[model samples]
Target: MGIGDKRKSDAERQERRRQRLAVDGIKPMTVHFPDQDRSIVRDLSRRVLDGQSIRQVMRELGGSNQPDGNVVPPEVLAELDYVKARLVAIEREAASQLAEIEEAERQRRTLEAERDVARVAEAEERAKVHTTATEAQAATRAAQEAKERTTEALQRAEKAETAIRRARSLPGVRGRLVRWLAGDVLPD
Candidate 1:
């Protein structure tokens, strides 16, 4: 095999070894450190090599198995529970009130929208009524003017009929009336 093929076979062999170790509760890891922390990495690696896992070293550094003077008392914990319950109740009440306010606002907006629609409808009705009233008034005026013209014409016709009767009663006017008005010669 070539050099590249040999290296690939070596990596596969190492991976199989890692899997076998993991099944026996032993896992391998790579640790990295900054150039300035080389000393720290060396110390950490030395502890791991001594059969102490990283977690054990970290637990010892974290002050485990030591008396803690800052332990919270049961009384304080109970009071904290009460305070938390009170805070939750306050938050729930505030949320309920907010929801109610939102509902009322929505209802108010709906009422306003309904009023706007009603106003538009009323305005349309008023326009229709006003137009009808104007048309009716115009028709009444036309009818009245026609009646007055007919009355005047009838009065003038009555006056002319009376004047004709008066002229015919005169002696010679009747004889001339047949010639001038009727265009006929007078018979004996």
Candidate 2:
């Protein structure tokens, strides 16, 4: 291809790569460094991806300059420090919130356990009350049966006493015979 066409093709390829990276949610680093220090910056980016703290990565990088003696700008270093502080603060806040959520969950579980115990106890008490009521009903029925039996016996005894009195009032041989058999003395 001609030189101009090659350049145009390379630009198009770079643009496509950038678009693909963006779509994949991989943000390109905005920090500019000397060409000779690109390897170090790439290493730092790798450490960040590996979940190292920003402060730790910065410490590892140290304040070393490029082989060409090109030091990072003072303003950029200051900005890095500021960003690291903000990240630390945000992490601390997240930890605090996580601790609070765990505490709330523990309390909720405890309350649920207590509520379950109360429900079980309430059911037990209801069972006891139902048993007591059943026993009372049974007792009432037994008492009624006993009273009915006693009343019937008393009625039979009264009828027997009336028959005995009527038999004693009869006057004749049969009455005399009945009195003798009943262990009553006969009248002269």
Candidate 3:
């Protein structure tokens, strides 16, 4: 009816109207495809409502066959590609850091094991020294006891010798002591 509305009853008239619509500056409303970040899709129904040419809009945005082989707006599709590349780089960095952390943990465990071994060795050495000192102390006590016994024996022997000498110095005590020692009774 008007310059924008080009609805025709006949097929030929519709074709002519479509061509005229393409020449006009009318375009479909753009819709952002959340699933596809790098591209957007122009709504053909909205284009018809706005008295615009759906074919022209489809052709302008790569004819609905995007570079990625999908009917998506070029803008959002490019953004998605960029996001994918960034995510790959981030994953690579994370993997590297994880490897480093694993290595560091391994080294720490190794050092701890070594330290435990050293501690055990040192403790064993200390135990050995303690045992040796105990043995030495016991030996020293035994030697001291033996020396005391020998001294007591010598003192007893010396006392018996002195008693024998005193008896000999007496007049008849020597003969009487000898008779008693021989198990024979002496005259009073």
Each candidate: RMSD: 9.9, 14.0, 13.9
Ranking by lDDT: 2, 1, 3
- Residue-pair clashes, model 1: 0
lDDT of 3 by residue, 1-188 (tens): 75445433465686777777667744434555677644434354555557656566656555554443346787887999999999999999999999999999999999999999999999999999999999999999999999999999999878876665555456786756664663332222
Top-scoring candidate (lDDT)? 2
| Poorly placed runs, candidate 2 (over 4 Å) | 1-72, 172-188
**lDDT for every model?**
0.79, 0.83, 0.72
* RMSD (CA, angstroms), candidate 1: 9.9
TM-score of each: 0.50, 0.52, 0.52
Per-residue lDDT over 1-188 for candidate 2, one digit per residue giving the tens place of the 0 to 100 score: 89999999999998898898788566766888899999988898888867777667776697533332346778988999999999999999999999999999999999999999999999999999999999999999999999999999989878876666677668998776666665543232
Candidate 2, residue 33: Cα displacement in angstroms equals 30
Candidate 3 wrong stretches, greater than 4 Å: 1-70, 173-188
Q: Local error of candidate 1 at 23, Å?
A: 49
Model 2 lowest lDDT segment of ten: 62-71
